[model samples]
Target: MDSFVNFFKKIPNKFASSAKELGKVQGIAIIAMLLALRVVLGMFANIGLAFNPYVKIGFTFLPMALVAYYFGPVCSMITACLGDVLSYVFAPAGASFTPGITAGYIIEACLLGIILYKEKISLPRTIICEVLVTLIGSLAINTYFIYMFYGLTYLQLLGLRAATLIPWAIIEGILVAVVVKALNRVPAISKNLPTT
Candidate 1:
C-alpha cells in the first residue's frame, strides 16, 4: 500500500523536473536539432504505401524519441509540431496541409516523450512505448485524419495500415532500445541529462 502511494507521489516530481530541464540552453539546442532532423527525415518518409497514401512509415520517430528521452515531453511536442509544419512547407506531400495530421504528430511525440523520458530504455519500456505510439499516432489519429480528409472508412484505413505498421512498430521498438543503450554509453551526452 505504501509502495503504491509513493509511486503515485513520485509522478508529479518527475514531470516537474522534466519541465524545468527544458528551459536550459542545451535543451533548446537539442530541440532545434531534433526538429531539423525530423524535417530532413520527413523527405524520406513522406511517401506512403501505394494503396494507402495515409500510412507513412519512416525513421523520423527515432530522433523524436531521442528528444523525448533527453529533454522530455515539452521539448518533444515542440519539435513534433514544428517539424510537421516545416516538413510540409519544404515538401508538400499531399494536396494540402491538414492540421489534424499535425496534431497527430504532436500527440505522438508527447506520448513517446512521456513514456520514455527519464526512464531506462529496457525491453519492457521500449516495447510499451512503441506500442502506444503505433496505436495512438499511426492507427488511431492518422486513421481519423485520413477518414475525414480522404473519405475513407476508419476500419479500412486501420486494416490497410496494420499490415505495415505492426511489423514496423516491432522493428521500431528494437531500434529505440538499441539507440538508448548506445546513448547511455556516452557520458558526455547522457550524463548531464536530468532524470525525468
Candidate 2:
C-alpha cells in the first residue's frame, strides 16, 4: 500500500519537468480536434436544421483559452485564430464577409485567451470568465463589425436575447469544462499540459 501510494505520487512530477511542456502537444491535439469538431458540427447543423443557421456551438475559444491559460497567449491565440480560419475554409458556413467575422472571431478568442491565460482552469472560474468573454465579445466588441459587415442589426445578427443566449453560453461553458476534465484523465493528454 505504501509503495503504491508512493509511485502514484511520483507520477505527476515526472512530466512536469520538460521545458516545452505537455500543453503544447495537448494544445496541438485539442486544437485539431476542435477544428474537426467545428467542421463536423457545422455540416450536421447545416443539414439537420435549416432555421438554426445563426445558432452557434462555441467550444473552440474555451479550450483555446484553456491552452493559453498555460501555454501563453501568443501560442494559444495563434492556435485559436488559425483554427477559425481553417474552420471557415473547410466548412464555409456563412455568406457574410469572411475577413471581417474571421477578424472578430480571432479577436474574441485572443481577448479571452489573454484574460484566462493568467487564471486557473477550474470550472467555476472558467465558466464565469467564458460567459463574460462571450457577452462582452459577442455582444459588445464584435456587434458593430458584425452589423456593418453582415448588414444586420445586433439582435438580428447574433439572435441575442439575454435569456436565449445566456443558456447557450452556459451550455458551451459546461461542455468545455466537462470535456477538458475528461481529457485530463487520459495520461497522454494530461501529460502535455503545464504543471499544476
- The parts of candidate 2 lying over 4 Å away from their true place are 1-53, 61-66, 149-152, 155-163
| Candidate 2 C-alpha lDDT tens digits along 1-196 | 9955864564344323222433466656655665565545444443322454444544455546555555544555465566667666776665743565566655666555554453445777567756886777665656656566555677777664344456766776776667767766889867876544
| Clash total of candidate 2 | 4
The candidate scoring highest on lDDT is 1
Question: Candidate 2: worst 10 consecutive residues by lDDT?
Answer: 13-22
Candidate 1 residue pairs in backbone clash: none
Lowest-lDDT window of 10 residues in candidate 1? 6-15
TM-score, every prediction: 0.87, 0.65
Q: Looking at candidate 2, what is the lDDT of residue 93?
A: 62
* Each model's backbone clash number: 0, 4
Quantify how close model 1 is to the true structure by its C-alpha RMSD in Å. Answer: 2.4
